[model samples]
Target: MALSEIPMGQIRTYGQIGKAISCQSAQAVGTAVSKNPWLILIPCHRVLPSSGHLGNYAVGEDVKCFLLRLEGLRFDNP
Candidate 1:
């Protein structure tokens, strides 16, 4: 349900999800995200690193970026 709210051209950090759910730890959220089997269906690619890095993806970072770009989301890493 949380994934359903991620609009196109937007993203949410693992920390944000964790914080919303009262987990208080992005690493734990990342771990749960890693277990997500739906991938693009659930839009896990919309989850970015808290530090603004692209980070890894189950389908690889290149594929992840491609999907985000396809959805018109920008990659603004520092």
Candidate 2:
């Protein structure tokens, strides 16, 4: 699956995944990602805001931050 292809320690934007599936908006991709039933398997944690800021996550922004930190990802202020 597309999510599985994303490597660990790497990050992707919603728009990038949207383009991969031919979706027009990153919002659309965010919707699909929010509904992903297999969170761990899909690795939605790897996705971040296009502005390089961590956005709201289904599990909460705190959790998102935790996951990103666990992966050693650093983000600059937007």
**Which regions of candidate 2 deviate over 4 angstroms?**
76-78
- Model 1 has a clash total of 0
Q: Count clashing residue pairs per candidate.
A: 0, 0
* Highest lDDT model number: 1
Clashing pairs in 1: none
For model 2, what is the alpha-carbon lDDT of residue 42?
A: 84
Error of 1 at 63 (Å): 0.6
Top candidate when judged by TM-score against the true structure: 1
- Report residue 54 deviation for candidate 2 (angstroms): 1.0
True-structure RMSD, every candidate: 1.5, 1.7
Candidate 2 lDDT, 2-59, residue by residue in tens: 6778998888899998888788899988888889888777899888769888877778
Tell me the tens digit of each residue's lDDT in model 1 across 14-58.
888887788988998898888889987788889888788887788
| lDDT (0 to 1) per candidate | 0.83, 0.81
For candidate 2, the lDDT comes to: 0.81
Q: Give the TM-score of candidate 2.
A: 0.85
Q: lDDT, candidate 1, residue 72?
A: 89
